[model samples]
Target: MAFDIYDFTSLTSSIHEGLATFLPPVGVLIAEWLLVGISVLLFVAVFGLILVYLERKVCALFQQRLGPMRVGKWGLLQTIADFIKLLMKELITPNKADKFLYNLAPFIVIIVTFMAIAAIPFAKGLQAIDFDIGVLYVSSVSSLGVIGVLLAGWSSNNKYSLIGAMRSGAQIISYELSVGMSLITMIILAGSMQISEIIQAQSTGWFIFTGHIPAVIAFIVFLIAGTAETNRGPFDLAEAESELTAGFHTEYSGIKFAFFFLAEYVNLFIVSAMATVLFLGGWMPFHVGSLDGFNAVMDFIPPIFWFFGKVMFVIFLIMWFKWTFPRLRIDQILTLEWKYLLPVNLLNILLMTLIVLMGWHF
Candidate 1:
């Protein structure tokens, strides 16, 4: 049978239907759900490795040095070697640590990231889960990682760990407002919180184009706040290695440490994916009404390609910030969020409201 790359739901439905013919109904259902989970897990694992390598290469390029080149073809297998080393390392806990919470934090972080990416559509009709309030659901679930961070810090019985966790909590809570408000500016314009629907609304033009300057401003705020929300530098006060000695996860080690490490990159993926879906147009190719040939050429590239292209671009932007900017002081981070981002986001939303009401978009 011919496959339609864009009609992902249809393909999955077909597979489920075919399996149901041989397998018991319960087995088919279980298999389908399990496959979905496995696919997402694999994506997270692979993306985490790729992101680590990419960041190293980017940092090397900026610093005029060689990155991982000996492990595999151009150091492609370097992350794999590092993963093996991390996987075999010891899982240590402090003598006075609260065992339960200290052990559970990393799992919580990983689970939240898995839940978040499920709501994000990679291609048309390709999300693992669908909800009317996709935006709200993703935001709420993703923010719950802070609980794990706080627990990890507090349960470690280390004053430094506690300090790091508190800083993380403050930073995430502060920046998330900017992230949500910035996204909402475009959501208000899109008039739907369903992520796929949001992308569909951008068929003629992306929010970055349709909503114009307000959309551009919203994207910038989201990028900055989203970076902070992920505990990434220059907003990486939570895990300030120079200050707190690895932040909330300082007391964590081994496979447990790997979980926290993976979650950080996965969180980065979540924000970048959301940016693609919300502002840059998820799975939507660039098109111009006046350029039939150009639009046709773009259509040939496929939706999945468009999705990843935009996501990678945003990820690169985040990495650039991490490498180029100096880490902000805790006060400076809060000041940037509360004083600048929050106010600008509020005004951007207002401007979007006016533009939407006036039907200014094409």
Candidate 2:
């Protein structure tokens, strides 16, 4: 029972062994599964609320307005108030809408957002599921949100919803190409798609630095592509109220509308987390070469701090774009994707390949 590394290891081994046997039992397994499901649901719900509040505050700072200060301390309870309002609102469906699909679409979108979290590495030895192709798994699962958006838009049987869905589909598909290619470059350098391995590889030197010029280019491309992929800010054509009258979920109301709103912010969080893993060194501590004192000082901070700092930086940038820029025309959006991001990302990948082959990393 003495405090030692082996003692901790033995405890973990014993727990794992016990779970291996216990999980096969009918009653215990069902209870454990329910507990896990509840935990995930609660986490998503809380995170969605916090993200909404954070986005509002961040935007207000940029625009020089007081954001939600009337509710709770510093508007801490703003999301809670909004939740109450949404809960009390009457559910409305368009007369011509297909009830089943319209009703199901929001849930599908929200569920897919939750599923994407399964592959994200929150901290050392902390993840819901660790698959071999972790990055690819995340990409595949996250993209399914588009299907829900398209379903919501088309099934609503409204002209605006249909157009929003079509715009969203095109936007996601186009941006996914650059996002995938940029992530692949990191996978190439790390030689693995597992999130933990990617973070481990960055211990000596983050890929953003080790991968050099090509990595920098890929990072920029990934940020732009990720923004577009989530249908956020300048790329938020899907919800362009001015043009599409609330876009894909225009016909949705009450709790169903809340689902779409929650899904959008959750998707934003996922993309930001992914970017931190790929380019900003995930949970790795800051290290300056040959500066042992500085490195040691930095290591005192918890790994989760590094992770959140990076995520927040990206979130702030997204908010800046949202408040500062006008929404792009659909045609201009497509043109920006095909004419710029695709070609630049392709060349950047080729450059990374050459750099890797030449063994130029320090």
Candidate 3:
């Protein structure tokens, strides 16, 4: 069989077949899920470390200095070293903290991240789950992480932690409206909520182009709101060191703290991946509707490459925002969501609806 990096279904099916020769059907199924879960966990760890390294380098570059040059060649393994250190650190809880909820919060946060990730489509037929309401499932389920944040703060008995948690809850709740509306604008054009269907609809041209101005508006809004949703810098009021001093997870340490840290970067990838699926066409290559030759060249590049490229671009854009912009005040954060993003998002949806109704989309 020819190698096809873009399509993992066949390879995985073949493996499943080999396993099935010795195992029951139920065991095969359980094995598939377990293997995928392990892969995703590894991805979370590796990508989180990569992001930390990238952000540090980006920050250092802006400041005209070398970043992380000590450990392994250019300090590439700095984060890994930190991970080991964290593993050995003591898991400390405040004397007055709620022992149960304080311990449970980090797991809750990380679990929700993986739960939402299960729905993401990586490439053609490269999805774990394909619920008919995949997009809705992602947007709704992902927001539940805020509950973990809230619980962490309220359980910590630290006023700073409580304040940070409250800020994050309000920020995520407010921006979720813009994120959903922006995605809905794309959904209206695609006429489906399934991630695969959304990508299929964009085989010829991405929604960012087909939906035109409204699509552009939605894309920009989604990027902004989604960045805020992840509690990243510029919108990182929830974890402002100058203010809340490590924010909601301030009381956490050791592996529990590691979960919170890793979950944040995983959340970053989740939002970026969703943006890729909703606006950038998921795994679709760039192609004009009637240009066969051009499309053939684009197709030759492979679907997974296109998907990875777009996801990385969106992730870079978010990282750029983090390094370039200063953190906003709490009031400014709320105002941006309530006064600007929400209104603009609502109107953009209305415009998209009109365009769809008028059959103006290509």
Give Cα-based local distance difference scores for all models: 0.91, 0.85, 0.90
Between candidates 2 and 3, the one scoring higher on lDDT is: 3
Task: Tell me which of candidates 1 and 3 scores higher on TM-score.
Answer: 1
Error of 3 at 173 (Å): 0.8
lDDT ranking, high to low: 1, 3, 2
lDDT of 1 by residue, 1-362 (tens): 33689677788888888889999999998998999999999999999999989989988987898899999999999999999999999889999899999999999999999999999898876898889899999999999999999999999999889999999999998888998998799899899999889999998888898889999999999999999999998988788889889988998888899899999999999999999999988999999878989998998988998999999999999999998999999899888988999998898899999999999977
What shift in Å separates residue 200 of candidate 1 from its native position after superposition?
A: 0.4
Tens-digit per-residue lDDT, 1-362, candidate 3? 33467687787777778889998999998999899899788878888888888778877887788999998999998899999999999999999999999999999999999998899888877788899999999999999999999999999999999999999999999999989999899999999998888888988789998899999999999999999999999999899999899999999999999999999989998999999998888989898878899888988887888887898899889988988899999899988888998889889889999999999988
**Where is the poorest 10-residue window by lDDT in model 2?**
1-10
RMSD in angstroms between candidate 2 and the native structure over all alpha carbons: 2.8
Model 3 clash count equals 0
Error of 2 at 69 (Å): 0.9
What TM-score does candidate 3 reach?
Answer: 0.96
Q: How close to the true structure is residue 291 of candidate 1, measured as C-alpha lDDT? A: 92
Candidate 1, run of 10 with poorest lDDT: 1-10
> Model 2 scores what on Cα lDDT?
0.85
